[model samples]
Target: MTQQLDFSVGMGKETTYGSPSAVTRFFESEAKAKYDVKTIKGSGLRPTKGVARTSRQSISGFEGSTDIELDAPTRGLGFLLNAVMGAVTNTLVSTGLYQQVHTLSTTDPVASYAIQEALPPIGGGASNVHTFRGCVFDSLEISAKEGAYLSVKLSATILKMLTTGATAASYPSDDTLFSFVHGSIQVGGSLTEPGATTLAVGDAIPAVNISDFSLKVARNLDKKGWNLGGAGLRSRPPVLGKPEITGKITAEYTDNVLRDAYLAQTPLVLILTFTSGSNVLQIAMPAIKLKGEVPTSNGGDVITQSIDFEAFDNGTASQPIFIVYRTADTTP
Candidate 1:
């Protein structure tokens, strides 16, 4: 029966496609079998042009239809089995798991890898392909000046998708998975001196989104309707989508978004702001708990606070965001 494969996960529903275990089992069975076939002949007189015989008894002794003794190699059971095994081996490696999946990696807006670049058309981040797990529909990034209040604005529809499916709906409707962590001090790019800065207290914050960009997934050549038993493959139905975070970063943040981030350790930074000061209060990026809050300065009255964030990696150059542990500044 033709299997109706709908991908809730990794397999091509029904039974046409063999699983990884099937190929593994096939290999195991191939190695253990003992019965084999072979063919050879002994000949003295030639009955037919292609007959297994020689003019003299030196090469082939003599010949008779069944009477001519079969050679050790071609006429034996080993030869027959060997021929059959050859075909089986071809099927094994050709349509095996190793041929399908290769390397796997995670990607985001900061860093990304292509899956379709490996294999086109058949190899897309769609229902048929695997490796697309926990991916969301879209993502965006927004940046703004700092202010007195803590906020992250979302100009882009973070949760919204290209296709308006309910489960994949965008903002002004549901909650978001990605959130902010610790808010901190950012070096103002525009500031010529230390005091000339902006605060993020009253602005919006948008999250760094990582979407359906695959790091790496191999080509499943033998991935048939009931293809390799990958919990990732789907028959006719759709495969699970990769988790995605797409939206512009803004200075506006909802109460829930800010509060939950303050509670959980997931997103790392949730709120950040800057104010006029003589010394550096804190650094923005990694989360850190400190005693006492930094009071806002006004010169008793001008622009009170100002700051903005730029993700940086101390040692590793390419990484946009880095998680690092801090200790006493003994050496410096």
Candidate 2:
């Protein structure tokens, strides 16, 4: 799933000079879900539902894991003007690059000096090879608009609601074609300005004036045998009214470099929510740490990171029955 993150970064250069101002975007609202859902909208009367039963069984805990891969897309590089052979570094470099060249800024260059410099410059423009699976995210790129930096904060949230179709007796496979909604941005463009702007359906930011957005991860969670009552202080509050089976995972940073680092190996939180009668409740996955981290072979260029997880339980059950993601509004 995708969420809004304010991505802005400057190494010794931008820091010494001045970093771009980061705009804060909160999760506004998502487009009407294609499913048959009942959400609260407008001011007037909010939707009121049933209360949670303290005596019922619930999931107590769980963890998040990850898997990742990377490739230099054709749009980003490969060939150059026939006369000039592009320089290439097989691995990543610690010092970030700008305009396809070594970024000269550094803290103590002598200490973390780049292992290798520039990799062969890849041509820019359309047909850039794209990589995505599970939940697809957007890439960062320079924008034509003014006052905009080139990066996304890179926050991601996923929700897994126990759908009616997925019962205690069912198990899903990689081939299952369930409906999914994802929201995200990579290393390009800043958050949109705040104002009374018109919003599109599924757009995280509302009429503007907020930083960050969220998407539905999974709906219809299930934990047939878990004892959710043990969650004492770790419990998430119930929402009175809203849309979708809301859940989320979020991490924030104005520094694109750091954000990239996190992308390589940062723990992301995922929340799962459910509606029973009139009450809406959520389940939490205690840990979202990545499975591992890998440095580029030569240069310090940050590439891919991954994580792993086994669906958790409230201790009442033995197997993981629920999933989680992000909500449209992240303010609370």
Best candidate (score: lDDT): 2
Off by over 4 Å in 2: 1-284, 287-299, 303-311, 314-332
- Over 104-218, each residue of candidate 1 has an lDDT whose tens digit, in order, gives 1232121111110011133344332212111111222222323222222111001101111112111112111111222242211111111113212212333332111101111
The C-alpha TM-scores of every prediction are: 0.17, 0.16
Worst 10 residues of 2 by lDDT: 109-118
For model 2, state the Cα shift of residue 178 in Å: 30
Candidate number of the best TM-score: 1
**Where does candidate 1 have its weakest 10-residue lDDT segment?**
22-31
Model 1 Cα RMSD, 1 decimal: 27.7
Superposition TM-score, candidate 2 onto the true structure: 0.16
